[model samples]
Target: MKTLYIVRHAKSSWKYSGIEDIDRPLKKRGIKDAHLMSKFLSKEIARPDVFISSSANRALHTGIIFCENLEYPLANLQINRQLYSFSDGYLVKTVYALDDAFNSAIIFSHDHGINTFVNKFGNTPIAHVSTCGIIGIKFQEKHWKNIKKGKTFMVEFPKNHK
Candidate 1:
C-alpha cells in the first residue's frame, strides 16, 4: 500500500511589497499554525518515508516545521521547483514519478492543485484545502504509477483543531 500525505502551505504574507509570489514568506499565524499542525500530525502518524516541498518560501518553511516536529532530518527534505506550481498537472506528475521503494510521501504544496488532487485521487470530496490543512490518502496499488482513487484516512485543518 502507498500512503500520501498532502499539506497545503501555511498562510503567506501579503504585506511584503515588490516581492514575487514564490518568495512570499509565512505570516505569524502561518508559523503558529504550522507548528500546531505539525505537532498534531507527529502524534497522529508515523514519520513518512519521504518529505517533499515546493521551492516557494512559504511551502518550504511549512515543510521545515513539519520535518522538525516529525524528527526527520532537515538535510533530507527534498525541495522541488516543480511543486511551486498551482495546477494539478505537476502534482499528478510528481506523484506518478515517485520512487516505488518508498511506501509513503508527504508533500507540501499549494492549491487548487491540492484540492484538485485530493478530490481526484482520494475517495473523499474536499471542496477546498485551506492554509495549513493536511489530508492523508492510502492507495492499494503496489506502484506509484498505478495508484488510483483510494481511501481518505485523515483530514486536519487549523480551524478544526483550534
Candidate 2:
C-alpha cells in the first residue's frame, strides 16, 4: 500500500512588489498556520517515509515546518521544480515518478494542482484545498506508478482547526 499526503502551501505574501511568484515567501499568518497544522498533524499521523516540496519559497518553507514538527530530517526533503507548477498534469507526473521504495510520502504544492489531484486521484471530492490544508490518500497498489484512484481518508484544513 502507498499513502500520499498532499499539502497546499501556506498563504503567501504579495506585499513585495517586483518579486517573482516563485520567490513569494509565507506571510506571518502563513507561518503561524504552518506551525499549527504541522504540530497538529504530527500527533495524528506517523512520520512519512519521504517529504517532497515545490522549490517555491512558500511551499518549501511549509514543508520545512512539517518536517521539523514530524521529526523528519530537513536534508531528506526533496525539492522538485516540477511541483512548482499549477497544472494537475505536472502534479500527476510527479506523483507517478515517486520512488516505490518509500511506502508513504508527503508533497507540498500549489492550490489548483492540489485541488485537481485530490479530485482525480482520491475518492473524496473536495471543492478547494485551502492554504495549509492536507489531504491524505491511501492506494491499494504497492507501487506509485500503478496507483489508480485511492481512498481519501483524511482532510485537514487550517480553518477547521481554528
Candidate 3:
C-alpha cells in the first residue's frame, strides 16, 4: 500500500510589490495556518518517509513548517522544480518517479494541478484545495504508477475540521 498526502501551499504574502509569484513568501496567516496544519498532520497522520515540495518559495516555506512541526529531518525533503505550478501530467510523472524506498510521501504544491490530480486520482469532485489544506489518499498498489482514479480510501479537508 502507498499513502500520498497532497497539500496546498499556505496563503502567500502580497506585501512585496513587483515580486514574482514564484518568489512570494507566506503571509502571517499563512504561517499560522501552516503551523496548525502541521500540528494536526503530525499528531494524526502517519509520518511520511519522504517530503517532496515545489521549488517555489511559498511551497518550500510550507514544507519547511510542516517538516519542523512534524520533526521530520530537513534532509528528507526534496525540492522539485517540476512541481512548481506543474500540470496534472507533470504531477503524475513526479509521483511515478518517487523512490520506492518510501511507502508514504507528502507533496506540497499549488492549486489547479493539485486539485485536478486529487479529483482525478481520488475520483471525487474536489473543487479546490485551499491554502494549507490537505487531501490524503491511500493506494492499494505498491507502485505509484499503478495508482489510478477511484483508488482512494479517504479524503479530507481543513474546512471539515472546522
Candidate 4:
C-alpha cells in the first residue's frame, strides 16, 4: 500500500502585486496556520518517508514547516517544478514518477490541482482544499502507476483549528 498526502499551499501575501505568483510568500496567518497544521499532523498522521513540494516559495515554505514538526530533514525534500501547476495532469505525473523506494510521500501544491485531486481520487466529495488544507489517501496498490483510486484516510484544514 502507498500513502499520499496532498497539501495546499498556505495563504499568500498579495501585498506585492509586482511579484510573480510563484514568488509570493506566506501571509502572517499562513505562517501560523502552517505551524498548527504541521503540529497536528505530526501527532495524528504517520510520518511520510519523503516530502515532495513545488519549488514555489509558498509551497516550499509550507513543506518546510511540516518537516520541522515531523522531524524530517528539509534539505532532502524533492522539489518538483511541475507541482507549481493548476492542472491535475502534472500532479498525477509527478506522483506516478515517484521513487518506489518510498512508500509514503507528502506533496505540497496548489488548486485547482489539489481540489481536483482530492475529489477524483478520494472516496468522499471535497468542495475545495483551502489554504493549508491536507487530504490523505491510502492506495491499495503497491506501485504508484497502478493506482487508480484510494480510500480517504484523513482531511485537515486550518479552519478546523479555529
What would the per-residue lDDT of candidate 1 be over residues 25-98, giving only the tens digit for each residue? 99999999999999999999999999999999999999999999999999999999999998998999999999
Candidate lDDT scores, in order, read 0.96, 0.95, 0.86, 0.92
The order by descending lDDT is: 1, 2, 4, 3
In model 1, the clashing pairs are none
Winning candidate number (lDDT): 1
Give a tens-digit lDDT track for model 3, residues 1-162. Answer: 888999999999988999888999999988888988888888887789899999999999999999999899998789999898657777898888887778989999988899889988885677778998888888888788778864555455556555
Clashes per model (N, Cα, C within 3 A): 0, 0, 0, 0
User: Which TM-score value belongs to model 1?
Assistant: 0.99
Query: Candidate 2: lDDT over CA atoms?
Result: 0.95
Q: Candidate 2 residues 65-94, lDDT tens each?
A: 999999999999999999889988878988
Ranking of all predicted structures according to TM-score, beginning with the best and ending with the worst: 1, 2, 4, 3
Cα TM-score per model: 0.99, 0.98, 0.93, 0.97
RMSD of each: 0.6, 0.6, 1.5, 0.8
- Report the Cα lDDT for residue 152, model 1: 98
- Candidate 3, superposed: residue stretches over 4 Å from native: 150-156, 159-162
- In model 4, where is the ten-residue run with the lowest total lDDT? 140-149
Q: How does model 2 score by TM-score?
A: 0.98
